[model samples]
Target: MVRRIGLTGGIGSGKSTVAGLLVAQGAVLVDTDAIARSIAQAGGIAMPALEAAFGRSVIAADGGLDRAAMRQIVFADADAKRRLESVLHPLIGTETQRQAAAAGEDAVVVFDVPLLVESGRWRAIVDRVLVVDATEATQRKRVVARSGWTPEAVDAVIAQQAPRRLRRAAADAVIFNESMTLAELETEVRGLWKQWAAATTR
Candidate 1:
């Protein structure tokens, strides 16, 4: 069996970026977000369940899930968010596990999960957790710049995630992304990949 590496961080902390670098170094990247998107597409695996839960309003003009609208609703309503998760998380988990299992002994599967820390269900599936970390200020600046969100919006997202201290404590490895150039980040990721390859092969 292959090892499952859970890579995660709060919004805009560069978890995706690190996962990309890892993929470049031969790790099979299993993006939970991408799986969610696929499962939410029209006539997708999770679409019927989601529509049954939230009604047809969550569907977009193209018949896909209206991600923007769903984001707004979830941010405003805790119960709605939980309901959405209940409908989607299992699908994502199943696909992720399917991919990981198919990879088998040759795989170094990296789960790029944004909610790994908050999602208690993940700990059971992942063999190790790699946290991409950055300072709060750095996170705020990056998220705001990328998403055009207000400080309050960024703070709201940060607050909803597991705190940095707790995430760090849970980490089997940490990638500190503050002030690092892309080249430097790649080098660090390559080193980590080698480490993973060695550790998992043994």
Candidate 2:
């Protein structure tokens, strides 16, 4: 049996970096972001559905989904977000499950989900949920720097998510991403990887 590890975190918490480390060690990396992008790509499995729901303006001139335009609309309207998720979530879920099932029996699989805690659907499927955590200040700074979002925009998004304390309480394993050096981070990841490998292989 392959072990499905759920990697989750708030924006800017470094969950993606940890997922990369897991990938480096040979875990099959299944990221929702990539899946979402694929679904939105022109002529993709989900593009027709998206175009039907959101209208053609959301599609770029080249025919691919205009993610930036969709993001702006979704962020501004909760209903828009819900509708978009309704269309994409099932498709993403189906694809993710299919890929996980197809991973070799000895595979160590990791699902990098940005909203795993908020979604509440993964708990039944994942063997373990690993959360990468950082302080609010750290998150704000990092997000603002990376996305060019204002502090207010960052806070608004954070406010819509499950609180850090709540997520930490629900986590089976937690990685503190507040301020460790890269080398230290890799060492921690390596230790966790070996432990996961041993547990799953047995």
Candidate 3:
């Protein structure tokens, strides 16, 4: 049987790095955030609904969703975020299902969902949940170094996500990312890949 793994982490926790390593090892990755961006792009399926709900102000000159403008509006207003999610979530879900179905029969599919813990619905669908974890300070420093975001801005985004404790509790496996070098991280991922491969074959 195919192993459906739900992989998640907070911003700057190196979840994407881990996902990339897994993909290199032949895992089929379904990244919901990427899917969300695709469906909100110019001429995407979600565009009509988003345009109807948020109006032209949230649509860019290129006919794509004005991501920066929408981000500001959604962060400022809870109702706006809900309205946006209502339009985008179903489309993302359908695309995710289609992608998973298209993967080879023996593939180990990983769903990279940033909000896996917050969403609550993924637990039932995935065989295991793997959370890439790091200290809050580590996350803050990484984000600042990589994205040039102010500490306060990083904190604001982290504040909006599920707390670290809740995410750790929800995880079936936790990959601690702080203090690890890239080589060490790759080794850890290799070990995980071997373990998951063994489990699936049995």
User: Model 3 off-target regions past 4 Å?
Assistant: 199-202
Mark the regions of model 2 whose C-alpha exceeds 4 Å error after superposition: 199-202
| Predictions: Cα RMSD each | 2.1, 1.9, 1.7
lDDT of all the models against the reference? 0.86, 0.87, 0.91
Indicate the worst ten consecutive residues by lDDT in candidate 3: 193-202
Clashing pairs in 1: none
- What is the per-residue lDDT of model 3 for residues 139-200, given as tens digits with 9 covering 90 to 100? 99999999898998888779888999999999988999999999999999888878766567
> What is the Cα-based lDDT of residue 25 in candidate 2?
72
Candidate order by TM-score, decreasing, is 3, 2, 1
Residues 52-76, model 1: lDDT tens digits: 8888889898788998788778989
Whichever of 2 and 3 has more lDDT, that candidate is 3
lDDT of 2 by residue, 64-180 (tens): 899779878888999999999999999999988888878876788899988898998888878888999999899999999998999988887788778999889878889999998
Maximum-lDDT candidate:
3
Estimated TM-score for each candidate: 0.90, 0.91, 0.93
